[model samples]
Target: MDKLAELKQGLEETWHSLGEGWRQLRDRASEALTRFTPVNRSRNSLEDAHSPPALASNWGLLAGDLYEDGEQIIIRLEVPGMVKDDLDLEVRGDVLIVRGEKRVEQERGHGRYRVRQCTFGSFRRSFALPAPVIAEKAKARCGNGVLRIELPKEARARGRRIEVRSG
Candidate 1:
């Protein structure tokens, strides 16, 4: 009877340990899924007030819009929390390369981080122009956390009219 009771106690302890292990695994998996899932926030959401601007990833992809207006091609990029000095742009052939770095600033006191969604690192985005452009005459400006680049299109050659000759 004594041996049987000891065996039962050992089995109970083993079951509890297994239960605790399973709980830890479930919690870790839950946290990982939450961290990786994308969350869409409204433009005027209060969450945006305290948290930094959301980036696509650590090496985030720069988001921009490219359009043409008559003889000029315009490109606008959203680069919040960045200064003009942090960005670099270059036009190589028909590709426009934009590179920049985002630095993380810690204002709050050091403590355990519950959630970390903000990203900070170097990012580069390249765009191929739809039409030939005069890269030398391009103009760029940054204002209100947006970068605007204006590229003048190359003049198209006009078709020449030929006079008909008598055979």
Candidate 2:
């Protein structure tokens, strides 16, 4: 009877120790996973964080391709559903400024709609020309909702490249 009591006491103590260890491991794992997860916030959290949110509001316009031709810098803007009259282009010194507004129609009797993607309001995009471009003679055209600006370099400002060979 004494040996059986001793064995039972030992087994009970071992099981209690294992249960405590498992509880500690579960709590530690929960804490580690919670720390690794990212916190969620409102949709406009990023907008609220910025002091001046004008640029952040119209960030989609700034994302585009900028290419340079031989003597002209061509800028292609993707302005869908916009006409030539709606856009304003300006060239001040070395800077080329493009401003436009996109309008969406809102009709009555329309209930709540899911907004998976959103694009709105006015946008202003500015680019700097590498060399002096003729602003007065510069021409811009819009076709298929794509605005192309041709900034031709001044005749005197165009440099002729001379290849130099090492001695």
Candidate 3:
């Protein structure tokens, strides 16, 4: 009876520990992530290649940062294994929407993946702007697997600079 009781208690403790860990992770990440799905990009003549069968674990995250700098909002997002042509960007209301596809580049024919850690799929990430922006004047540049977007502020959205003088 004692052995059975101890085993049950140990199992309960382990279960609770795992649950707590998962809860903490969810609490930290549940709001920061956006939906990611697979997109099939049509191959050009230069990119003609075969793709491996999709596995169950064919999903990943696109991490990014959005901050205000002086008179503009700058957003930088991690987009490895992708190009400028692969991405699509747009802004509606106060939200900035970015869509892109990361395709699997086949280096050789008839090869098996011994280790597939990197994710290849389509993903969209959105950010809420702190202030209204001049969407027409926005500038975007991409390099080194990072997408940088500079959104200029609208005329009314730019805050007035005030100087305090000691009386």
Candidate 4:
């Protein structure tokens, strides 16, 4: 009886140690992947190829949300470290493009100056309009480095209903 109990306790200890070792290995692997993945720089052609036209910028472009609400569409972008004057909004034909540049202050110290992360660049995002919108009536507001655009639906073309005539 004594030997059997000792063997059981020994097996349990080994199982717990193995579990801890496995967890450590998994954590190290996760850390390595996080370190290797490159951080977003700006709206690059490679990364923005899959996204919509309005979501091409490198900064807020990746973090913005596009919502459609029946008669109106709203686009809210999270653009930190940028001023309202630095952004330019343009609409050409059926496409809307948002462009902006974010500048970072230079470091004063002159020692080693190693930069581990970089989050500054110019970005341009274009969105294809599903339906015609009132470009002239569009309104934009910028507050706390976030740009919000409200596009009102064109009254002339709001899913028109046609009557069926019998021949």
TM-score of 4: 0.55
Model 1, which residues run further than 4 Å from truth?
1-57, 157-167
Listed per candidate, the RMSD to the true structure in angstroms reads: 16.8, 18.0, 5.4, 13.1
- Which pairs clash in model 1? none
True-structure Cα RMSD, model 2: 18.0
Best by TM-score: 3
Cα lDDT of model 4 by residue, 1-167, tens digit = 99999999999999999999999977655422211122344434223324343322223223566677668778887777777887899877777788776664334343432332434456676777777788888889889978898888787656767899999
Backbone clashes in model 1: 0
Model 3 alpha-carbon drift over 4 Å, by segment = 1-34, 41-56, 106-111, 163-167
**Weakest 10 consecutive residues of candidate 1 by summed lDDT:** 31-40
TM-scores for the candidates: 0.57, 0.56, 0.67, 0.55
List clashing residue pairs in candidate 3: none
Model 1 lDDT at residue 25: 75
Instruction: Report every candidate's CA lDDT.
Output: 0.69, 0.65, 0.77, 0.64
lDDT of 1 by residue, 47-113 (tens): 3345544423443335678898668889998777888897899999888888776665444544433
Model 1, residue 72: displacement in angstroms?
Answer: 0.9
Candidate 2 residues lying further than 4 Å off, grouped into runs, are 1-62, 161-167
